[model samples]
Target: MYDTLKDTYQLFEEIGRGRFGTILRAFCPVSAESVAVKIIDKSLLTDETDRACLEKEPKIMTLLSPHPNILKIHNVFETEDSMAMVLELCEPETLYDKIAHRPLPEPEAAGLMKQLLGAIAHCHRMGVVHRDLKPENVLFDSRNNLKLADFGSAEWSGEGGSMEGVVGTPYYVAPEVLMGRLYNEKVDVWSAGVMLYIMLGGIPPFYGETATEIFEAVLRGNLRFPPKVFRGVSPAAKDLLRKMMCRDVSRRLSAEQALRHPWILSGGEANPMD
Candidate 1:
């Protein structure tokens, strides 16, 4: 079905490479604009899990897309030997690239977090769960506007809602996910919390040398804010982080609730982002 993708999209430069495929910056001569394309070799799709994971992506994006901060898909198709997805060309950078060097100005960080939360709220409202939420998966366009990308780990929440799957980056995985219990979109909130912790402190709240050790530390749910580390961070910021980073999924703030948190909505009148 997508055989023409080869003739339609002319690869320009490689943008990224992942476990499953190569992402390239390509131009579709017919459209006269650049877009990102993920070309998946047929050999990988034959594996049941790989195909199962990616097959739903096009449909999911179609169902819950068009949110300003959620990555948008232009087209998706498969041919006899490969599958491809043409997507919006976000800047070849991620949230991590920005903050990993130094934290953004606090108010600016708050505004950016607000955008991220808004995107996640949109996903939950549509009954879609972004099983993976981390800085590496969040992108920024040329305007510095945020867009959530990498939906390969995303899943649709059906009527029953709760799902069981040990997925997501180790440092950001929620307590329930680490415990092997049924989980929901709240896991994304927890992961977002971990990302927040990193953005502010320049380190994850829980850390260990190995994944197993890290999982154990995460399960303990011990959080720390040494004065030197969080000195300039506002109390309201800490308050929201604690709530979002809560261990009990039931107690954690939902995405909508989080958006309304004081730190986000009350960052000050002079704030241009408000």
Candidate 2:
């Protein structure tokens, strides 16, 4: 058991909170470095299952520590009252917030996609699958550099790892996972495709008033690309999207292959935000 801090970490404010807990900005006393502290309430973790999941996050963070594009976890400590995780502090908003403000320019969107793919590829190489890959989970540093965060739903695929449990945001989940089919790293690639589509087209490819309708559309595997909205979107771009979002996991392009697609390689002047 860990002792509770007499007072909250100074020099920051409470920025966000969710069902799990709250996130606050704090300065490291030793390095004077700024970071985000995720505080998980011990009281909320009433079962062994919840405790196991909480403990797994730190282990996964350690495995992913070396990746440049992934968020860096500096420390994990348990107080009598809460479990605190110190993470590198990101900037004012997430990718989701940025898109909500305005659609991304073509170059900017492509650049972000490239960065995210680099991160995902690194995780795959390490035998970890980020079950949840969505715009909301991607954050930006003060320099506007992208960092992948939120590994609460992540799982390892290496020897002795379990793949059970239905997880991931509906908008970005691959068909295989939705259908209860066994899946692998390709699921991340599918979610990446959905994210890229939203970045380029200004809205998700599939949206419905209800969750059932959205899942039905996803299962159908027909993602419409409106040329008018996605004006100047290259054929290569469309092709890559189709390959990544394929219903059949085996048919989808791997993250590495998608990174090298002609559309991604070709530098064009078209800006989606224009």
Scored by lDDT, the top model is 1
lDDT per model vs. reference:
0.84, 0.80
Clashing pairs in 1: none
Which one is best on TM-score? 1
* Model 2 alpha-carbon drift over 4 Å, by segment: 1-11, 46-49, 79-81, 160-162, 267-274
lDDT of 2 by residue, 134-185 (tens): 9999999888889999988888876743365568887888877878766788
Model 1: per-residue lDDT, tens digit, 174-239?
Answer: 989878888889998999888887887788899999999999999998988978888877777788
Error of 2 at 28 (Å): 1.3
Q: How close is candidate 1 to the true structure, as a TM-score?
A: 0.93
lDDT of 2: 0.80
Model 1 RMSD to the real structure? 2.6
For every model shown, what is its TM-score relative to the native structure? 0.93, 0.90
Question: How big is the positional error of residue 198 in model 2, measured in Å on the Cα after superposition?
Answer: 0.3
